[model samples]
Target: MGSEFAEKVILITGGGHGIGAAAARCFAEAGARVALADVDRQAGDRLSEELIAHHRQALFVEADVSEGRDCKLAVERVLDTFGCIDILFNNAGITRRANVVETTEKEWDAVIDTNLKSVFLMCKYVVPVMASNGGGVIINTASGWGLVGGKEAVSYCASKGGVVLLTKAMALDHGKDNIRVNCICPGDTRTRMLVEEARQLDLSTDDLIEEGIYRPLGRVGEPGEVAASVMYLASSLASFVTGTALVVDGGGLAGSA
Candidate 1:
């Protein structure tokens, strides 16, 4: 496992923080050259520097992933730096916690475009490169809510649900090309995104995370935990695995109602 990705290159969206950042560190530790793309330039640059300081190969690209042009440029920049991308993690995402009635058009578009469309945009550019290069891995970040509905997040639920099917469709289409596509359905994890979700609901991060305490594991997840799942999906261990949503929520959805 340590040497499995020694010379491979990984391009990660949302790689500035949270699960993306955590996964970047894990891959770097495994000897992969990592390219992080994020709209948050400061956070992205900081993480890249941190990884370099630790003797890891890392690059940061400022990108608004929801747009096609930016996604193309991001892929181009990564290829320019790393030569090839063996894995593409479409992990950039956002959430708007609101029911249909409360979710504005802007909010709905933001959630859908970020959570779902970004996956398609990135794949549109990277898939051809992977195909020409022989093969590659794609790990998308869908949520447990994508499998089950959330109380006040209609748009988020809808977008993630789209991701689930989109992942499958891509897997079917790309399997012949030897390009594996899968998505992770993680339960509540401790990350900046969780903090933003808490803010949307007017609850403290601890209070929000407490909602996940009833899961069998009885705790919110750490970003590294979810990142571990990402590693598995990207690794050869899942060579025969594609189109599946590997849930990493510590049983968060085992008892979903």
Candidate 2:
């Protein structure tokens, strides 16, 4: 175990699976006490056990991040258990694969609340704790589609876009308090969410996976890769970095022309 983050406490939303789970493991491996908050109690508890089995400090908090009360409660539990939050990974999000017209009001609200508002809610409570503690790091998970646009993913794109901008705004507001806020815009990553996105679009999983490899990197990214990026942004190595959207998208957004 590395001690880079030995005394740090990292709270991750959506910590049950995919990139969120990968990030929890990564931070724990680096010696950080990790708080896993997710709507799925089973997955969250399972991951916490796995980490504890490895002798890592870990806690699982069931939370629906979209709700302010849940976000507040999750932060409170982490603070009570870990002392103070040194880092926060706002990785909770959902996707609604539909064009604007085909998208219903509820679907749009759900995506926005989960993907964007959760970041705000988490920050709303965590920022003060971080500020009083002297300083901290926050890394949000945006998407490549957030920077650009995607067909049949209006709600997803919009929500992620909001996240990207919200990250920047928070960074600007919190830099004075020594809180660094940054977001990663990943390309097609191999996650349950990605698989479900294909299903929503009525596409074969094999076909979708195959198409993902057409990017410059010639392969879809794994959750671990994205987790690594989050780790970087959360570490002191990025002390001077803030208000930036770090793209980890295998160059998919690179113009073909």
Candidate 3:
């Protein structure tokens, strides 16, 4: 496809690394002004610099997405710099590998806040801007676990499940305003988060990755692969898509109920 995002403004959270960073590059390369928000100042700044070197408009905002104030400030910075927000990618998230019994209150809170509440906070700020602008696209990062149960990952599953439903609710409430809300449910993407899950579960990262490849597609997904789905959902190509969980899971959930 040609540059579908030319002259557009895109805000991506968790843009410091992994899928978020990849999505930032994808949108920027497609000609969007990308504002990257993340808790990691160094990574975000470095990526922003790199994007600018590529002749794309990019800004890095250091903000903990778990806090509403930080979310508001990030959106404000984007608006102040870019003049308007055309796309909002609520991609900031963290994962913890613990069943309900094993998960502590603090850990649960941290995961839920980062992975779920962050979406709510970002939307609270960006939705109004999109409504004022007439229309926009919002893409949230959900997970395959959000749709199906996974062993020893209760909190992660719960948080992503919330994202899925939240996307639907936002789509329903905002469609009249020309804002489309949707989510990508990716499975076993090769990222730091996936490796950390292996460490948390006391399994070798190699073994964990091998097991992930047991899916019908015979391999774990790349961050760039998931980014492609985000691009599709964010662009005009998916104009009719909304309130849907687009699974980019390499058939991991295709055989399931």
TM-score of each: 0.98, 0.98, 0.97
Estimate the TM-score for candidate 1. 0.98
lDDT of each: 0.93, 0.92, 0.94
Q: lDDT per residue, candidate 3, 105-212, as tens digits?
A: 999999999999999999999999999999999999999988998988999999999999999999999999999999999999888888888899888877667876
Model 2 TM-score relative to the real fold: 0.98
Candidate 2: tens digits of C-alpha lDDT, residues 65-128: 9999999999999989988999999998889899989999999999999999999999999999
Q: For model 1, where is the 10-residue window of minimal lDDT?
A: 204-213
Cα RMSD of all models vs. native, in order, equals: 1.2, 1.1, 1.3
- Screening candidate 1 with a backbone cut-off below 3 angstroms (N, C-alpha, C), the clashing residue pairs are none
lDDT of 3 at 194: 80
Candidate 3, residue 110: the lDDT equals: 97
Candidate 3 lDDT (Cα, 0 to 1) = 0.94
